[model samples]
Target: MTLLQAFVTLPVLLPMLGAAASVIVSPRASLQRVIGVVTLALVCVVAGVLLVSADSYGPVVAQLGGWPAPMGIVLVADRMSALLLLISTLVTLAVLVYAIDQRISDYGRETASTTFHPIFLLLSTGVSLAYLTGDLFTLFVAFEIMLASSYVLITRRTSASRIRSGMTYVIVSLMSSLLFLTAVGMVYAATGSVNLADLAGRVGMLPEGLKTVLALLLVVVFGIKAAIVPLHFWLPDSYPNAPAPVTALFAGLLTKVGIYALLRTQTLVFPQDHPSTLLLVIAAVTMVVGALGAVAQDDLNRLLSFLLVSHIGFMLFGLAVYTPSGIAGTALYIVHHITVQATLFLVSGLITRRTGTVSIAQMGGLAQTAPHLAVLFAIPAITLAGLPPTSGFVAKLALLRAGAGATPAAEIVAAFVVLASLLTLYAVARVWVRVFWGTPKEPLVDNDPNDELVVGTARSARGMYVGASSLIVVSIVIALFAGPLSAIASRAGDDLQTREAYRSAVLGPDTAPGGPGPVPVAAVPQGPAAAGGGAAIGAMTADDAEGTTSR
Candidate 1:
């Protein structure tokens, strides 16, 4: 294997190795902190290198253990994977620094510093692995790795509430994982292969009935992970209770992974001749429902969680449009959302740390006391509401343009998207009014008297604020550099529309050089008719819908 390939794989491997090494070498709190910071720094460096290499050399694929594609495990880094990896690494590194700062105050420095480092590194490893894996089975394994590590991180302090929330998170994640496993098993039984490239090649040949079933199953599994409307109940329940740093990472990275899986599997593996109107309808409802839930929430974390769900539907709208513009918009939205969401969560954590509560009703006039915190929160809040001069604006514009050009139903989808953004604006504004604009309801409290030396010291909360600001700055950077980023996104969308690029990159160039293979003939049930009363089954063509093609 080439040195570049080895470098690409180390981002995933280093964290897992670090997790174990941290546990074995020394349980010293200071040592663990050093190890965690160093390990994540290395990861970020590797991720940066990979992104640069991908930009110049195209996607990098490494056969695990030197086994070739289609028969052995493979890790591939395309534009999409590379971009997401960079975002994830930045979020992890920021959170790690914040965690180090808050270790003693939140959980005793000894326990918080040691336990968190190992689990968090493991979680980072799993997230990286999930993004890079080329095979469906490896994706599942990565999902488990992430879920397991997160389970520990969520319940790190083991409080009653933390344990309860962690249990809910664990149960919901495990059930989704099981459903995903079942779907994988069924797909393997039907197609005789679990490789994503191979599955993409064979999906069109499967009977319409089985194809519909597999697609529906996948939607359920990914929906659970993405926190889509009805399936999103667990997020508000669990996210607010974890450590602030853990919550930041969860808000920023985990749900996006689900969205990534949905986009990857739906568009890449199961290319359909016609777009699924069902997904379009669900996207609309998800946007409206999630926003309404956010409006009802008074807790800072719960509000952000609901908004996360609502924003996901915006991305879904782009995916539903099944156009290059829509896909590109979704890609941009993913980047925008990750940065904005992480910033908000970290800010919320700061609020909780200072005021000793996340309840909006119990906190007020934070802007006066902590002007920096207020500014940090404001940036993400405005961005989340899709205000101008932000990446969020660019993302929404792409979706609106796509929706305007789509069918009549797409017009309604566009309307819902707009309304959802407005509602998000209202919700965030309400939090602003309640938490920052009013008279101070209570003074800041230092709960740990023994830690007086660090209490209100520059090192403790400053690190948290710095982490939050760093992410907000990234959102601004994305907005400023929208031209180049949009160009890359457009190329990604174009590549997706023509699956040959992806297929040839994953499978060999000789395996269907120009387009996907012929459609398969396996039999399964079909979904209900389209929303406009059109028949679900109709004439098929290679380029009839986004990503659909005859093998």
Candidate 2:
């Protein structure tokens, strides 16, 4: 493999290796923390290099262990994967730093040694693998890796509530994985390949009814992960109960992976003349339902969890359009949301640390006592609400433009998007008003020695602030660089639509240009082919053989 290819792969490998090393070495607490930070820092560097290299060299692909495309595992980094890798790495790094400090504060030096470092690194590895894998089956494996690691992290404290939440999370996740596997099996049965590029080529040839069934299955599988509407009951229950940093990471990265997979599959594997209209309706409902849930929540973490679900619908709206602008909007939204959401979660955790609770009713006057924290929270809150001069605004604008220019049905979808944003703003402002502006509802508690901990101390708040602020700064940077980023997203969307570029990039230029080769007009069955041996089966097998020969 070349140097660029190595850079592309290292982000995933570094975390996996570091997790194993952390377990075996049994390092000192400080050393374990160092291992986690340094390993993630290295991943950040590698992701950055891959981003630059991919921009200059175009998409990079590596066939694992010297095997060829159709037979071998491939790790491919296109503009989309590279962009997600960069964002996810940054979020994981920030969360890792915050977790390190939070552990020290909450558990002190003794028990901090147990599982945080190892599990977190493993989680990073799983996320990285999900973004890098080039095919469907491997993506499923990556999803499982992430799900298993998350289960351990979520239930680490072993409280009754935590255990309950963890069980729900595991059950939901396992069912989704099984659904995904079944979808993959169906696709493979129809197409004879699990490689995404190959599937893209063959998907258009499948019968309409079968395609619709496969598409619906995929939507359910990924929707469960993305926390879309009816499938999102697990999110509010699971996320708020996990440790703060774990919640932050989950908020920032996990659902976005689902979004990524949804976008990839819909755009690449099933690009038909008229895509699923039902997805548009789902998008609208997801946005409205999620925002309404957010509005009703009084607990800070639960509120944000609902907001996360709501914003996921916006991304879905962009993807549901299946146009270049829609896809670009979705990409920009993904990048912006990761940083902004992680920062908000971190800041919320900081509030909980200071006030001893996340219930907004129990907290007040934080701006007076924790001015910096209030400002930190405000930055992301405003951005999340789609305020101007932020990446969030850019993303929302892109979606609005796409929606306005889309089919007449999209105009209604656009109205829902606007309504959702307005509701989101109100929801976030309610949190702001309750937490930062209202009169102190509960007296400052200094009786317990632990409660007497000073606010704004370098030791207590610095690490958390640094982590949150770093992501906040990144969100601003994305806003400033919006033009270039949007261009990259547009190109990525274009590549996804005309997947010949991706197929050639991965499978080599030898394959026929428009896609393997078109099925002969006479070969395509007008209706269902016969189930048992007959002329229809013979024709189907002959068609498959001919297509393979052309390749």
Candidate 3:
């Protein structure tokens, strides 16, 4: 591998390797934390490098073992993918710090010592790989990696509630996975390829009947993951039951992966003439339904969970429009939401920790008890509501402005988007008034139900404070630097909308536009390449070949 290829692979390679190493050091809490932090920090730096490189030099790809295209596992880093990678690692690192310092890990216990760090690192690896991979099956593998880790993480404390929710989460995820795998089968059965660039080259030639079926199939699968409206019922139930930091991590990473997948497949694999119409309907309904759900929630965690689902509609609205300005706005909104949502949840964690309850009905006067926490909560709450002087406002303006050009449909979705923002403001404002502004409602006594979860409140650590605050600072920075970030997002949007650069980058220069045809998958490994690579073309995957079965 060339030196640059090494850099391209580092973000994936380092974290999985670190996760493996973490197991050996699991007996030592300090050492395990060090491994997890350093691994993510390095991945962050690598992701930053890839983001700059992709923005400056165009997309970069590495084919393992120096093999070619669909024949080898390829990792491609484009501006969009790298941008996602950077923010994911940042959130992962921040959430990890919070978990560690909150003493939530219970390090000396075997389960805590053995499971948390390894799964945590593995989860980060999954997010990075999901963003970076070039093929559908590889993306599926990455999703499974994420799912396995998440299953363990969500059920960590083994409460009945946790197990029940985890079961729900798993069933939903498995259904998505099964749909995704089925879609992959359809894609390969139809086009003889699962590599995204190859699929992009060939999908345009497919019968509209097949294309529409494939498009809807992929949308439903990803919709389930992104928590878009009707499919979002599982999220509010599942997220709040996990540990605070774990929930924050889920808020930050998981659903966004689904959104990212939707964005990728929409632009690359399923950009048929009429798909946007359905997307618009989904976006509008998701915004209205999610915001309505948030309006009645008294629990802060569940409330944020609903808002999380609601705001995905904004990104979908941008995608539904499917224009450059629309996508750039979506991209910016995504970066904004990831940080802001995670920060809000982390702040929620702090609120639950400091105030002895997440329910505002019984919670009051937290500002008097933890003034700094009040300010911390206030920044993200206002920002999430799309109030002025924050990145959320910038994101909302960009989406609305983009919507203006898309006419009556975009305009309708835009209205829902605005309504959702107002509802979000009201919901968050209620929490502020009831919890932080009023006098104590019940005196936070030892026997209080809220106090049951507030162990070690007086001794709260700096890591929890600093981790949540750092992301808030990031949200502010994005707001302040909206102009430059918009440029990057615009460039990324251009790349996604224009498939030529990605094709050429992943499949070599001959795969550029105006090609006779996509460089055939068989041709990828024909010269001085593995014979089995060519033989594998248009075949069922190994898991399929081995007869995958539920039981």
Candidate 4:
């Protein structure tokens, strides 16, 4: 393997190694924290290098076990995947710091030992693997890794309510995993290959009915993960029950990973020539439903969770358009949302620290005493609402431009986009009025000792602030660099549309789809071939053999 190819694996390998090391060093709280932080920091740096390499030199392909694509595990760091990886690693690093500080403040340095660091690193590894994997089966494994780690994180130091909510989360996640596995099986059964580059060439050749079923099945599976609309019921309950930092990490990374998978698979395996009417309608409904849900929520985390679900529709809006501009817009929105959503959740953590309650009704006059906190909340809130001069506005504007097409579906969904933004602004404004603008109120003290409501020591609070502010700065930097980022996103969109660049990167120029010899078509049954018979099976097998021999 070349140097660049080897570097791609570090993001995954380093974290797995670090997780094991963290396990061995368990109960050494300081060392575990350093290992987790340093591991993520290294990943962040590696991801940055990958983004640069991919943007400048095309995709970085690493075929593991010295095997080739369509046969062995492959990791491809394309422009899109590399960009998302960098952002994810940075967010994970920030959330880890915040968690460490929170732990120290709530339960001293010695008590901050055991399962947390290892599991968190494992989750980071899963996230990196998910983005970099070049096939479906590996992606499933990555999801399982993340789910296992997240389950432990959510239920770790919890009350009865959190445990119950964790159960809901686990159950829902397991169901989606089963569906995802089934989809992978169906795709492999039909195409004889699960590698994305291989599937790119073969899936289109399947019977239209069978292809459509597989596509929709994959969509539903990812939709459950991404928390879009009707599938989003588990999120608000599940996320709000977790500790602040864990909620922030999940809010930012998990759903975006789901959306990334949707983008990668839909564009590669089930290429759409025109805007999907079904997706557009779904986007519209999700935006409205999630926004309305947010407006109705009394709890701060629950409201933010609803807004997270609502904004996912915006990203879906871009995918629904199925054009280069639309995809670019989606890419930009994903970057913006990942930063803004995580920042909002982190800021929510700070708010809870001060107010000692999740209810907006119980919070008041924070703008008077904690002006800095107000500033932190305002920036992300304005961004989340798609207001002027922010990353959210830039991303939303791109989507709007993409949506101004001749199609009626685009126009209708565009309207819903605007409606959702307005609702988001109103919801945040309500929080501002209730939580910041009113007369000062004492912190609400709950009887539950396990309730995640504590104002930490000044030093620890400073650590938490630093963590949250770092991401806030990141969101600002995204806004500042919107022009270049948008350009990069446009290029990424073009790459996805073309498909050949990715195929060549992973499968080698000689073996890439449409290169050398006839493209291998899967021996899937159709029409009379569907009937069970030795002759038909033998005929299909013979055809496949001929195709393989020709290659």
Model 1 / residue 128 / CA error / Å: 0.6
1 versus 4: better TM-score goes to: 4
Q: Cα deviation of 494 in candidate 2 (Å)?
A: 1.4
- What lDDT would candidate 4 get against the real structure? 0.87
Q: Number of the top candidate by lDDT?
A: 4
The TM-score measured for candidate 1 stands at 0.90
Worst lDDT window (10 residues) for model 2? Answer: 449-458
Whole-model Cα lDDT per candidate? 0.80, 0.82, 0.82, 0.87
Residue-level lDDT of model 3, residues 1-551, one tens digit each, is 37777788898889898998899887777888889999999999999989988888988898888888867888999999999899889989988888888764222223337888999999988888899999999999999999999999998767677789889999999999999999887776656667888778666555566668888999998899899998999999999988788999999999999999999999888663322777888898888788888889998889899999999998999888888788888999999999999998888887776655667787888788789988999999999999989999998998998888886877887888899999999989998998888786543433433311443345567888989999998899999999999899988888887777888899888657674245443332232223333334333332232232222
Candidate 4 structure quality by residue, lDDT tens digits, 416-502: 999999999999999999999989888765456555545421233577888899988888899999999999999999999778889
* Per-model root-mean-square deviation over C-alphas: 6.6, 4.6, 5.6, 3.9
Q: Sort all candidates by lDDT, best to worst.
A: 4, 3, 2, 1
Please write out the lDDT profile of model 1 over residues 62-137, one tens digit for every residue: 8888887777888888777888888788888888887777765545656634566788899999999988998899
| Most TM-score-accurate candidate | 4
Please state the error at residue 394 of candidate 3 in Å.
1.3
Better of 1 and 3 by TM-score: 3
- Pick by lDDT: 3 or 4, better one: 4
Off by over 4 Å in 1: 104-114, 444-460, 513-515, 518-551
| TM-score of model 4 vs. true structure | 0.94
